[model samples]
Target: MKKVLAAVLAGAMLTASMAGCSGTASSSSSSKAASDSKADSTAATSTASAEDEALTCTLNVWGPAEDQAKDKGNWLPTTCEQFKKLHPKWNITFKYSACSEGDAGKTVTQDPSAAGDVYFFANDQINTLISANALSELGGSTVDEIKSSCSKEIIDSVTVKDSVYGVPFTTNTWFMYYNKSKFSDTDVKSLDAMLKKGKVAFPISNSWYLPAFFIANGCTMYGDKGTDESAGIQFGGDKGTEVTKYLATLVANPNFKNDADGSGLAGLRDGSISAYFSGSWDAAAVKEALGSNFGAVSLPTVNIGGSEKQLKSFSGSKAIGVNPNTKNPQVAVALAKYLGGADAQRSHYKLRSIVPCNTEVLKDTDIQKDAMVTAQNETFEKTSIIQPFVASMKDFWTPTENFGKALISKEITKDNAASKVEALTKAYKNPVS
Candidate 1:
């Protein structure tokens, strides 16, 4: 049975512990026009008046727990407050957690029928849940509104059968970022120059390498064309082979190493490393890693036997989603709309330095003026979306995780990685394919 809603009153915001500066509660175009930087904003303005008159109306939310500590705006408490303030008649309770690589498959198995009103899911989980009907088809109400505010690309994995079930959440693209204090102007011009001549490190254990290299080498990591079955990462196919060779190239590079753990952020902070492949949000981490000495670029483009794409980074931005089980979906949808709008997304970005899905938010002079944001838009448009399937995190990502672990550990060699991926792909579709 679904739980009753309750007022989302006061939870200590853990924003101070997160990186980035505080946001100034102002979204004026003129105010934002001069600075290219967005600050982390958490001013206690109860703009959502609806929350005041609300009672026991709950909203179940599941997502990355890191946001709890690192982001002030996107998490359950903040978003719920914003939502409740708008619809004061409906009080909401939130369930939160951070599900990452190893823990991906374990939790969803516990309560499929009533997991939460909404969950922040990825590509690996989609197919598995589709057959089980554990997921509610987002259908008519809120999905398009989400698409309008956030982006359609953000929810690509959750789209199936010409219909969308999940609202856009998690930018979910993978690539590399660098610390410039460790590099120079000449170092970034080319891949060969940077790899053999500059300092670099990458988190080998993280599957970021697969999609990063696959795309850098001009190979398809996920399908680009929705209509073509073989176009995207469909279990096992050309993509797996491309992934194998791409890994081989990086391993062979003397400037790059397999033992590296975290895109050189730790090393940059410690003054031992200079550059590496990583996620977009790591820009803050990079600054934390090498304060006053950080500059990053898209991961270097490379040759996979001989295909070529530009360098890019891994991304994971989240959006608001509505639960199918909600008795008052109209209110939920309205709240979700407000949450994903420019005002809310911009505020959240100020709090977390997350790139906004609302294209207009990006236009805010403050955000658009940044050199990195300008450079990133190009990459974001072209790079691969490497998140796990959105249907079923348990069934899809676990096998993919095992495959990733195997690939990184050399248990699956470059020569055989393709075949292994094919096996995993078959396993992914399990009874269906």
Candidate 2:
């Protein structure tokens, strides 16, 4: 939004820059495997006549400005060129548009038919895109490749009603960044430990960042796998109150500070804070601030009510999707698959420091060596939960944000943590229209 080793080299130098497409992708296995096999066959034979005819078409594609950069070898255009070479039968004229993955779904929903035939989007927008009938149900080797390349959770994130629609490129989540000189290796594993020893900043007032506490203490949204809308949100009762009480104590601690208005990075720069939480987006600033003292890790455990709970960040992916409205469905699907497959992800990493979510690419010698990649991959697989993207999720943010604001304002206290949590739970279920 947010490590391993000393990472003596600045992560900024390693990764380069952060793009805004935050969130990961995923789907169910047995059904997906069967679907993949069937689709693989159809993909091969369905376009046979088109291949012979040498179909020519003008294709519109959309992605982040970073990928379209001419200076960086034009990842988007270069990849498109490569796709053209592979499908020599298809004479493709590329038309490009600058659209961030995070904004893809909303923008496309406004006018799906007018949107690019192929585009990159955040996985959390799956539901919204589906509701608007803006996302196409992907099939063939593209579906097979996605199944083979990504983790189950990654696959599930892009799935709506058991069908996968997007091809994932990289993980989207947050982790801890610390000054190595201030905290020991063991200390980095525990949030309370870091807080006790050095100045620590956390985004306690932000809804997106606040859920780490509740998630650690057993709160869940849309059930365990985050796919069941009927399950509703489970962020209530004794478990929710426990987290509220913990946060109250955390905010009252002298060594703790709430990150807001860029104070986290400023604190790191001025040497006022020893550690903070964020995603790959802040790597450069953190690296420049701490230099040789830079360190990173997955979310740490927190001691809550005499018990240690592992804090889990919300994780998702940025992926490439196809529009069913495309007149040239065959070419559009092929191009979409090519852009998000392992090869494209590798190129994306080289060009933009966009970490790859493809399992095969993650094992590359160079990729494996990057400490930031190691930390991010670990957090994506271990200390993270998928952010539910169902329509019901719209009711989540404001109420959670209100709770966070109250915590920072001291309106929420250990003395009334239970009552406050009860109120938040009610708000979650009965969000005002």
Candidate 3:
């Protein structure tokens, strides 16, 4: 299959060159004719080299059930079909199966050889996937095309050690979802103001959302950008304790609610909650519940130590990765690229309402008009912080969750906030030890 595609590409290049020479033949000098002939020869040689590197193999692909379902215009199967058309002789048979993006990293790490040749996963898994030697690095034209096609932040999310390890499909992060009828535009900008209007459901017990408070107070998880595993936890000292005390106050407010389940969505639907903190995954349901009253915006600022600080949500991306252990490594990489490419991303947007990461797709006027997409873009630009992909980050979730729960439960207070912060910092810095 690869050879056939190569031959066809080579023929096309040579034909185009020959046609150009024929058009100029009557006016061309001997030197000019020789130069054109040389150019043609170069084209043929490059095509031959590319053909030699072309891949021919069946690939196993994994993604969410919705992305693989035939009825949903699943991008995986559609992408595979399109890829096969481009590489006619390539005997590319894709075995599609169910695997959520969140589980892909752990699955690949557990058994690289048995994992899918191409799989969808969250960006936070890059460090662990690379450490397990489970992901393949993209190179050559593929890497170039990816860099040209996606946003800089999207590209950076999948890049490790200056090499791209995956192709980003969609951004996976939280923005603010609120009931417009309950709170005005100005009301939503201040967390304190929103709380006064009605109950606001935020999963304060979850580590994912808990960091927003500390981040607003200028606390960091690891060193700069969450890299440098050796740097350990920086969520201590004055800023950390200050944020902790503030959170203790917020949780004590009657309008503050802790909900980890779909209860928040239920609250929105029942008109009991004015606003909530969550991502695009809940956009559809919230839209349905609020109808014309639906409003999505960037996270609001919160009062901290007598000053208001912008709440910074953790930002991430969902991407497609090639397994390093695949028998057809090149084919796997190609498949990963195809799944996250422009066409596939557009399809994802139309079918799933997923905000595409592809630069061209994002520029589409219709995509730009989407409220969710616009709000998310604004959030990423103004208030989002990149979630680190380092291995040490694995230690952050449990300790942070415990700390958040303790604060909400009234077990940690202003007087004891410093000591508790110190102990949690020590545990986070030496999780395994």
lDDT (CA) per prediction: 0.50, 0.78, 0.75
For every candidate, C-alpha RMSD to the true structure in Å: 11.9, 11.1, 10.1
What is the Cα-based TM-score of model 3? Answer: 0.85
RMSD of 2: 11.1
Residue pairs with backbone overlap in model 3: 1-89, 1-90
lDDT of 2 by residue, 113-164 (tens): 7888788998988888877767777654567778998888888888876678
Off by over 4 Å in 1: 1-56, 70-75, 91-109, 139-141, 150-152, 155-158, 184-186, 215-249, 259-263, 304-317, 371-376, 385-433
RMSD of 1: 11.9
TM-score of each model, paired residue for residue? 0.68, 0.85, 0.85
Q: Tens digits of per-residue lDDT for model 1 on 153-178?
A: 66564566655555553354544456
Candidates 1 and 2 compared by TM-score, better number:
2
- The alpha-carbon deviation from the true structure for residue 410 of candidate 2, after best TM-score superposition, in angstroms, is 1.7
Better of 1 and 2 by lDDT: 2
Q: Which sections of candidate 3 miss by over 4 Å?
A: 1-56, 70-73, 430-433
